[model samples]
Target: MASSCIGKTWCSSARVGLSLSSCVASVAGKRNRFAALLQREQGGRKVSVSSSVRSQSDPIGGIQEGLVCKPSVVTGVPSELARSRRRAGRTSQYRFIMAQAASADGAAGVDSSATFPTVGFLGLGIMGEAMARNLVKAGYDVTVWNRTASKCASLATEGAKVGLLPRDVTEACDITFAMLADPTGALSVACGEHGAVKGLGPGKGYVDISTVDGVTAMKINEAVKATGGEFLEAPVSGSKKPAEDGTLIFMTAGDKALYERASPALDVMGKARFFLGEVGKGAAMKLVVNMVMGSMMASFSEGLALGDKIGLDANTLLEVISLGAINTPMYTLKGPAMVKGQYTPAFPLKHQQKDLRLALALGEEVVQPLPVAAAANEVYKLARAAGLGDADFSAVLETVKSHSRGSTSNDH
Candidate 1:
C-alpha cells in the first residue's frame, strides 16, 4: 500500500491519481489522514470559516469554544497509535476523519452514519427550528442556515452541519426547505445574491414552507425552474405547537417528482400533506385557510363581546359555541385563552391581517365578492393599529372591546 492517507483513508502517498491532501500524520509504519471540522446539531444554520480561522470553540464538546485545528504532515505512524488516538476522546486536537455516513433510526429518524439524502434547512425561526429538529430526530443528515447564527448553535450539537448562505444549503443538499418570516424574506433568500437560485441545478429540490402569496410562490417557482431545479410551495396550516408535534398540515404544489421525493421528510414533519397540483394552488390554499380563520376569529370576538354585554359569562358563551354546529378546533383551542385575556401568539395578529389583506385582494382580482373577509380584514387591521400586531390573532377581542366602549359612549 502507498504510505499517504487521504483524509482518514489509507492511500498511495505518491500524491497522484486521487489522493492529495494537506492533512496527514504518521507514527512508526502507519500514516493516517486527520480531519477536524465542526458538525452542528440538527436545527443549526450557517458557519463558514477561512481554514476555520474564526472558529471560536475547540473540537471537543466539553469546551464551549476556542478550538483551533491546524493540519501538520507526519511521517511513519503505526496502527496502534491510531487506536490510541481514538481512545483519547474529543480532547485530542487531531481526530480521525471517517467517511460521511448516517444510521437509520427505525422509521422516525436517522443516525449520523447512514447514507441518505442530506437535508438542508434555511431560516431557524420557531417553526423552522421545530421542523428541522423533527428531521434530525428521524435520523437524517441535516444542514441548516439562518440569518441569526446564534439560534443554530444548539442544533449543531445534534449533528447538523452549518451553512453560510441560502445557496450553500442548496448546493450541499439534494433538497432544501425554507421557513422564512414572510414573502419578502422568502423571495430575497431564494433570488438574491447567494440565494437558492444561484446554487440550485438539475436534480436538486427547493421546498418553501413560508406563507406567501400565490404570485410570490409562482415567481420563486419560475426562478428555481430556470435553474433546472424542482420547486414546491408547501405552506403549512397549523401553528407553533402543531409544528413542534409533527402534526402540521402541508399544502404542497408544483413539481410532482419533487413532491414524491420529499414524502418521507414531509411525513416526518406533518400529520397530513396535500399535493394541490400547482405552485400557486398551494399558496392560494394557505391564504384561503387563513382568510377563513381571520373571519371566524373576528366573528368569535363579536359574539363574546355581545354575550358579555348581555351579562352572560364569556365561558358560558364559549361552552355554548363549543357544542354548536359551527364549533371548530380553532374555537376549542383558542376560546379559553381568549376568555382569559391571554394572547401569546400562536399566530400573530399582524400576520392574520396580512393574510386577510392578501385574500381580499385575491378575491378582488378574481372578481369574487368577499364582504365577510373584507370586513374581518378591517377588524384585524384595527387590532394591528391598536398595537396588538405581535399578539395572538385572537387579541382582536381588544379591538372589539374598544369598539364596544366607543358605541356605549356614543349612546350616552
Candidate 2:
C-alpha cells in the first residue's frame, strides 16, 4: 500500500501491492506508543489518540482509505517549531505524523500541509500598530486598517495587506483584533456602518483589545454574537513600550472557544493572558486595574513634588524609594525623566484620565466608594486643564509641582 498523511489526522492510501488491512492493524496496536512518543516530544503535553479506524475500499478508483489517527488539539508547542517552519518557508501546519509513520512502517510518503488562518487588525494607533507589526513578523497573514489610512502604510511596507475598511478586513480574515483608543472608537469600528460586525459570521472571531467600560464591551459582544460570530474582550495591561516589545498582559473574557482559537496570535502579541469569564468581566478588571494605577501615579507625583519642595534632590529621593519596600517599576521607569521635566507619552495622560473616569462610574454602579481613585481623577483633570493631557501620565508630576508652588506663594 502507498499511503500519505492528510490534514492533521487521517491517512489516505493508493492501492499498490502491500497488505493495507495488516498495516492498519499493526498501527492500531501501537496507538499507545504513538501517543507516548507525541507527549514526550511535546514536553509532557497530553496527547489523546482515537481508538477506532474506519476504512472504505473504493473498488472503482483502486484507492483505499488508510488508518485513521486523530489527536487532541495541542498548543504552546514552543516557538522553535514555528521558527523552523518559517525558516523552511512553509506556510502550513506542520505535524509529527509523517515522521512517526516513516519510523513505524518505513513507508515514506508526502504529507499534506494545512495553511495558517489569516488575521485582521483594526486601528493602527501606537498600540495597534506595534501589535500588528509583531503578528506580521511572526509569519501570520495579517491585514490592517485605520481611520487615518496613512497609519496603515508603515505596516503595509512590512508585508501586511491594507484593508479599505474594518468590514473589509474582517471579511477577509478568520480572526480580527481591534485596539482602538477609547470606547467610542471601539464601538464605532465594531458596530457602526461599514464596521467589523457587518462582515462577520460563523467561523469568524472578533477580539476587542481596547480599554472600555463593561457596558460598551457587552454591547460589542451582543453585536458580534448576533452575527453568528465569536467575541472576546481582551483589554491589555501595558503602555507603548510593552506593546512594542510584545510583552503586554492580556485580560480576556467572553467566548472560551474563541480564546482557544486566538491563543497563538495572542501569544505572539502578549507575554501573558488571563481568561476572566464572560464579556463584562474583562472590561471591569481592566477598569479596576487602571483605577489603582491612576491613584498610584497621583501618589507618586505627590511624593516627588514633596521631596523637591523639602530641600531634597528628586533623583536622590527616587534612589531612596528604589531601596524601600514601596518601590515599583512605574516609579523606577518614569521618575528620572519626570524629574528632568521630560514626559514623552507612553500611556497618554488623556487616556489614563479616561480610564479613571470609567472606573469611577463602574464603582458607582456597584455602589462601591472609590475616594482615592476619585481624588486621582481630579489630579488628572487638573493636569489636563494645564494642557498636559497629550503628555505621558507621569506628567502629573508637573501639576503637583505647580500646586505646591502656588501654596508656597500664598504662605509668603
Candidate 3:
C-alpha cells in the first residue's frame, strides 16, 4: 500500500503541545496564530501516524483509561487554512468506550468518575436526537438544543437537560457536539450571534458531526479556536439505525488533545473510529466514502431495472444479488423496498446528492478525476427532479426505470 506523510518523522517516539501561544512570532510586524510543532528527523520518510492513534496505557489529561497516547498536532498550517481530522477502528480501550453504564449490580464497565464532564448537543434532528440519547443513556451528563423547541422535549424526558439556546448548552458543558442537517445550520449555530461559540472558552471543545464541506468545517474551527475553545471535525458514517444503536463510525480530526478528552464520549456514540490527521481529512474521507456509496446505489438501481425489463421478478433479482459477493447492507436494506417501489427515507435522497456534489468538488480541488461520481450525481439529480428528494436515496430505482425503459413508475 502507498504510504502517506503527515509532515513529521518518528524514530523512537515523541509527543508535544508546543504552545502555539509562544510560537506566534510576528511576521511583517504582525503575530501569527498558526504554529508549527517541532519535528525530529528519522530518515526523512515523513511520519505516517498509525492509522489508529494508539493511546498510551496511561491516564490522559485527568481522564482515565488509554486516552494519554495522542499525536502531536500537525503544525505549520497558515492561519487562513488550519484544519485537521482523525478517528480509529476497534481498539482495546474502545471496548470500554462502547459499553453503557453498568447495571446497578456493579456490572463491568461502570463509570464511577465524579469528574466525568457534561456534554452539550446542538441540533435535534433524526441523527442528533439518537446520538444525544446514546450519550445520556451511557451516563454522561447531556444537555440538548434544537431550533424547534418541541424536539428537545423528547430528549428532556429521557434525562437530558433542555437548554434554551446553543449558548446555553455550550456554556453549561465541557464539550459541545453539533449534528445539524446541513452546513448552513451547523455554521449558523456554531458561529452566529449568541451561538455555541459565544459560550465556548478555554478547556471547552466542539465536535461537529454534521456532513459539510471542508470550508465550512474550517470556518467553524477558526471561529471556535478564536474564542479559546478547541475544535474537532467528527462527521459520522452511518444512518438513523447506526446512530440510534450507538454503532456509528466516527471520522474525527483536529485537536488531538480534545480527541483524548472526548474519547469516552466518542466511544459511547460509535462502534469504530479513525483519527485521520488534520481537520479536512475526516470530511474528505466521508465524501469519498459517500461518493462511492451514491454511485453504487445508482448502479444498483440500474441492475434492478435491467432485471425487471428482462422479465425477472424484482424480488428474485434482489435475492440473487444478496447471495452474490456484490451484496451489501445498502442492497439488503433498500433492495426489497426499491423492488416494491417504497422510498421511505432511511437517508434522504437529497443528502446523498449533496454528498456526491461535495465529493465532485473535492475531486476538482485535488485534480482527481471522478467520472463515476459525476454520472451518479446526475442520477441522483434525476431523482431529486422527480420530487423524490425527501425519499430514501434508493428512490433512484424509480428514476433508473424511467431512464432505461421509459416506464413512468415514479408517479407514487
Collision pairs in model 2: 1-18
Quote model 2's TM-score: 0.76
Cα shift from native, residue 126, model 1 (Å): 2.6
**Candidate 1 at residue 371, lDDT?**
96
What's the TM-score of each model vs. the native? 0.72, 0.76, 0.74
What is candidate 3's lDDT per residue for 275-394, written digit by digit as tens?
898998889999989999999999998888888888998888888889999999989988887788888776899999999999999999999999999999998998899999999888
Task: Pick the TM-score winner.
Answer: 2
**lDDT minimum window of 10 residues, candidate 1:** 67-76
How far is 356's C-alpha from truth in model 1 (Å)? Answer: 0.8
- lDDT measured at residue 93 in model 1 versus the true structure, 0 to 100: 23
**Residue 18 Cα positional deviation in candidate 1, in Å, after optimal superposition:** 38
Q: Write the per-residue lDDT of candidate 2 for residues 1-412, one digit (tens) a residue.
A: 2123232233433221223223323453445544454444455554322221112221111121232231111221223223323322221112233223322342333321112357899988878999998887655678999999999889888899999999999999888999999999999999999999999998789999999999999999999999999999999999888888778889999998788667767766777778999889999999999999999999999998888888898888999999999999999999899999999989999999999999999989989999999999999999999999999999999998998988855585
Task: Give me the displacement of residue 285 in model 2, in angstroms.
Answer: 0.6
User: Per-residue lDDT tens digits of candidate 1, residues 267-291?
Assistant: 5687667899977999899999999
